[model samples]
Target: MQTINCPRLIERVMANTLESIMISDRRGRIIKVNNAFTRITGYSESEALGQTPAMLRSERHPPSFYAAMRAEIDHRGSWSGEVWNRRKTGEIYLQWLSINALEDEKGYVSHYVAISHDLSELRAREAEVEFLAFNDPLTRLGNRQLLMNRLDQALASCREKGEVLGLMVLDVGRLRPINDHFGMRAGDEVICTQAERLHLLAEASDTLVRLQGDTFALLRHSQASVADMTHLAERIIKDLSRGITLQDKSLLMRPSLGIALFPQDAMNKENLIQAAESAQMQAKSQGRKMFRFFDHGQHSEQQRQLIIEHDLGELIIARKHTGLELYYQPKMCLVSQTVCGAEALLRWQHPSLGWISPGEFIPVAEQTHLCVRLDRWVIKQALQQIKSWQQQGVDVPSIAVNLSAHQLDQEDFASWLASEVAHEGLNPSVIQLEITEGAMIRNGEAAVALLEQLQGQGFSISLDDFGTGYSSLSYLDSLPLNELKIDRSFLQRIDRDERSLKLLRAIAGLALSLDLQVVVEGVETDRQVALLSQFGHIKVQGFYFYRPLPAAEFRELLDLQ
Candidate 1:
């Protein structure tokens, strides 16, 4: 066997090993270093040799830390922990280091050997993770966690200073609609631009945060009163109402703002956020581009609505197999006083809550993608009923089902509707879709194209609740509408209001000119019917003819007719 030189063996081991190896003489001067030591410290072996390891010390540790490390090494012969060191480039980095003392045969310390692994990347990654936990990925604004922390700190300050704090929750009301229209990239740009605007609006003492998608929170301390909060909310609303240009297209962000004052509206962070959100909801309900201060009554109503919304989500999921029914309201031709078509309206047959009104739950459904499912379910049920009615020898001409903006804009709704209709072996002409003016316009060009597609497939489309929304006359020509239903509001005053009469005549004449049939809704009285019937061949539907009925009851009405 060949005998190995001990010093050469030690040098080979140090040179081959990956760990940074440094050797110091008994007097604490660096005697040697391996290639890894030079690589990690950005120092050449020639530069590092003869220099003490203290030259690489980052000065981050307290004297006590070094003293404890020394004490451990003296007592236990080795010390292992994290340490901060500086590279030759003057950049500081963390290192996991293990140090051992080497002794001669006399048992006195002769040299110190330290093995270190560079930990800069790991430390940076840890710091980045911490930052991400409190920041929004899209806007780099403080996130929900940071929002809560800031609110907690503000509440504590309010307590100490005996001053009021204003917490405002802002919802970009147009975000979803804009996303549907322009795409998510533009939506993200809008959110980022809004964040910058909000950041500018915030004072140095205020904390502005993006809590979640299209939702932001601002905490303002040292508010003089609730009025101050209101003013701030109004300022936010005004600033956000201005249009933002994205991809060279102008987009408006109508912000609905809610303000809750701490120590008055809420005493804690969660409750404060809840109250501000409640107020923001109230603002949205009142109108878009507005602000509302938290009122106890509104808050309570919001809480009740939240419960209904939660239940509504569950109800929608189980609607196909369980708690859902269609109620038909007969639409009668005014001249014959005979039913021409029936409107299919949704009713939630809640097991515990009994009959929940569509007016209450439909809005809740519209807020989520569940509205698309609900719309599809309504069509499927309506078409299935039509087929059943025809089989039983009941002549149901057409069934009018209301359409929502969300459902209409769904990726492939037109094709899906056609597929569903064909699957039931039902004639497309036997189904009429009623869309409100607001929903129609909200969907814009996409809606016009879908309406034309449905019309091309022999499906009738009706512009329902016509006069309530701000629709341009140019849109009427663009859309493939088969009918225009006069809003019930106009009919309510048609008997007395000459202006209402003239407006009705003009709308009916316009529909006729466009070759679209005219329908009048909410004909609850004989006088209203008589007034509405005077308009040539217009049709009528209301409580006066028949309240909405169950499928069986409606079938009975068909039989009686």
Candidate 2:
């Protein structure tokens, strides 16, 4: 049977199709033109018949572009693409084009035909869609898809270059409070501000991508060293640590970072991302405002995490094993030099570790989603204790109960506080909620909104560890904060360091100006107490007055006072 030939059909389609079609000699000069060519170029057959298609080149592409394109066609005998071309009216339009070589008889002589369709409108629409798809609405940074695409490209480039590509992934610490407690509008401000902060921290060559929610991805072509990565991460942490004043409220920053290096920790794109993510999980597990690197012994770390997770779950729910105890430290009145109030701090008496510091177990509980229960328990216990003190006619000033960023992120924490107060038959204002300044800033918008909500409900908020953070005073002015507790470090140095006294004076002065109550923590001696007196009307808590005592011992101390 004779084979059916297709070249004749190709010729007919190229010569008469709707798409602009042209025939050229082997040298690429136009030898013939179709009707659609005249229609698209706004030139009659006479004007385009012999003119080369290059005459329609819009100059958007470089000269070398056409040269390389021609070379490809010469070597392969065909080319197809979307290229910009100019109409006779001088308007630049995009064209979807296809070209093929035609040969006859001995297959030694040749001609080429090109078919093109207008694609300008399609391209414009695609661009608009692409923008929406690849960017975060609030931050205007690359979203997850864009970040992954870039990571893929960076991995490919790293493989080609035989160099290490560093990936720095950051999770804004304490950001959940802003989004969960405050409305999303307030949370948007935090996210937007973070983008600006990251832009300044990342090198010019690095790509900064916002990876959905509070996560960000940074890709560097080459890392100078581990120190350089750490320096960059620190810059990000410090910049974001600055107070965020939104509307009438303010917030602080807290973040955690993880890093993975290409060709070192991982070579493939998936492995690189997994390593970075694993490191991030480790950072989050440690606490916010921390950085960690990928460890090859990921399985062991995972096993450790599993054990901690198991213990945390059991600790929160299993009251039989959980040695939940409340500790009290007296807060002294600066002028009177006597105990005016006390901070109710939580301590876990681990049957194994003897005393598990709040620092360790709190973070573990928060990450494992056990903090909600633990925080609720602490609040209830504190409120009940305060109510009991009041019932005994102890008439103590408000008892301060510290709150965690994770606790504020809980949807019902504020209302839960209200219920706890009502349950204990105590005034909401009698229990002041203390949160770290670092938590406030990192959670900027969310924390501020939550503060206002909790404040509006008659609960008091205190800026804990005031001067040690970026700016607790600024947040105090914006948030409905009732007190500013000077960090223990500042007070410890007060007697020996004049600078600290002056600094404490400045903070106290600012607190007075803003009508905020001032409290100095960790005052250990008569000399420290005398030095702190210069600050005026400040409340003090330290071993100099009394160490953190258990409930029974604290109640006895309360009777004595």
Candidate 3:
């Protein structure tokens, strides 16, 4: 086939195309230029005709950059990538450029064709995105992502040089209140000013980053020891606690710092930050303007508590799937010596964590708002067991479920309990609620009203761990309580301590005077049980008679009764 050369067709296409197109002779002198070339380079075709492509050199790139680019194009016959070039007005801009050598007959290079797309706007947008991703826009400080990257690098350097890397997490405790009182704009100003102050305190090798709202992180590279970390944290706390002025008003800011060390607290980036956060929590707990070093034991405990909290959250959602459990310890009448009732004790049998005591997990649950759900589950389980026992013709009188302060503090707790009990189809008289004296004391009037409402609904209310808290007799007289349970601590020392017996007797007398049934807990020894039997018409509960039993075992005990 015979080929036809269409120079005019090529010229027409090049002139109308968006991409800048230029043809240069073998000596690299521009031979022709299209409209797009003029548009992108800001030079007319007439002005560019005799000029070399070197006229567009941005000078941003070093000599080696051009040399390597030229070598690649010559050897490969085509090259394409990002390049910086100068416009006719001497302004530099980025471009995606492609160049190909045009060959003459016998494969001799005759001319070069170059095409380029303006990338200045695209590059600018990319830079903005990258900046936003790794920086806090409000404070212009490195964000958490950037902090993680720097932490990873810091850890690697520490390992290589046998140095310690210290990480400090600072929490601005007053920022929330400041934001609430002064507005977000003022809060932002405080943050930016704090960042500037923190940046000024940082060493040349140290990195200051913003982790999240009112939280900032610092990476101290090549630290000497715990002393170095503590010194740095102290300096930061002192400097930051001096306060900043926002809107012409001086406001004091409290700084709580957590410091974690390399190869000591953690060896990786994530754990290092976590350790620092743990220490920061400890610092905050100890009061503001203070710092705490990451203790291995404390971090482990924090992590374990975190795991328990997480597991409890999951268990709350999956209670029906066997995440939570309840064990019952029988409460016996002193005169009859048979099972009168039992307390439904919350138990957690984590699939992997095994059995966790209520003492270990209950506080965590209460703190995380999981207590209400957990308490509901306990009530449901207790009601189910009660129904099962009733169907089996067992004479179990009542099953008491403990309520946390968190539960009683809820505004609708009484109604919620009544609804749950009714939903389970269990008679309210057969179910009892046990509340600690502390809970009643903390909740005060709300607790009393709820307890009275529940009592009015035919649910027996017992004040558990009665004498442990400093609840006055006046307060106890006003509570709509059916029973007062003597705390285990008094019973633990009942056999040996005369004072304990006097205290127990006084408490028993108080319960009797108030027309409340008295129940003594922790009746472990036979001697103590005998001593407790003297109280007459009292109830006893503890390990001597029965340890807490699983639902199945408790059911068997009910059959035996």
Off by over 4 Å in 3: 1-134, 405-428, 441-457, 475-477, 492-500, 555-561
- TM-scores, all candidates, are 0.57, 0.46, 0.74
Model 3 lDDT, residue 9, Cα: 78
Residues 213-298 of candidate 3 have per-residue lDDT tens digits of: 98999888786488777777888898889868877888888889988888888878888888889999999988888999887887
lDDT (Cα, 0-100) at 400 in candidate 2: 81
Score residue 9 of candidate 1 by CA lDDT: 96
Q: Which structure is stronger by TM-score: 1 or 2?
A: 1
lDDT of 2 by residue, 232-261 (tens): 877877787788876677777778888888
Candidate 2's TM-score reads 0.46
True-structure lDDT of candidate 2: 0.79
Per residue, candidate 1 scores C-alpha lDDT tens digits across 282-352 of 88888779988889987776676777788877766866436788999998988887888889999877766
What candidate 1 gets wrong by more than 4 Å, as runs, is 1-6, 57-76, 152-163, 171-196, 221-224, 234-256, 263-275, 278-561
Please, what is the whole-model Cα lDDT of each candidate in the order they appear?
0.86, 0.79, 0.86
